[model samples]
Target: MRAIFFDETDAQAVVARLRADGFEAALERERLAGEDDDEDHPWAVVSDAPAFMLEVLVDTHDGWLDEGDDDAGEHTTPLAPLDLPTAPRTVKRPDLG
Candidate 1:
């Protein structure tokens, strides 16, 4: 199980808690391309814990899971494209009486 955390303190807390619970966990830096700010890089926690266990911790710590790098196995369906108008939106529509 893997979790990405924006706060270093949260990441460390998770790691400590997991270790205390007899689970193997490791914390590392998660860097993405085009991310110029070094301090903005999120922290990654890789552990041998179960998904549910990790999910609970992640939810409580304001973090999210990194379910591999593949989006092919995702079950979610993509939403239809929005047809946005090019012109400025009016404050009041004539049809809304």
Candidate 2:
């Protein structure tokens, strides 16, 4: 699957994390037309991992994935956090008198 990232660093970070997690990932430079050298262009992250896993990574790291097709045609959305089956967190507040 392919997903758009903000910049090369973010793309590389995703690739590194995926590789560390035992998934193959790579980045492809996507330059827009009429963009100058100084302008920031986005990169696309390509991975061979499962969609769910990619989604999780994207969600946790603030990335976005391509959601192909709907009544309104193709669109992209930020990955939503998965509902993991885990224990809830406990927060302790400081005693303020």
Candidate whose lDDT is highest: 1
User: Which runs of model 1 end up more than 4 angstroms from their true locations?
Assistant: 70-97
In terms of lDDT, the poorest run of 10 residues in model 2 is 68-77
The positional error of residue 82 in candidate 2, measured at the CA in angstroms, is 44
Candidate 2 residues lying further than 4 Å off, grouped into runs, are: 33-38, 67-97
Using Cα atoms with residue i matched to residue i, what is each candidate's TM-score against the true structure? Answer: 0.69, 0.56
TM match of model 1 to true structure: 0.69
CA RMSD, predictions in order: 8.7, 15.7
Summed over model 1, clashes come to 0
- Cα lDDT of all candidates, in order? 0.92, 0.76
Q: What lDDT tens digits, residue by residue, belong to model 1 across residues 8-76? A: 999999999999989999999999789999999999998989889899999999999988855534557
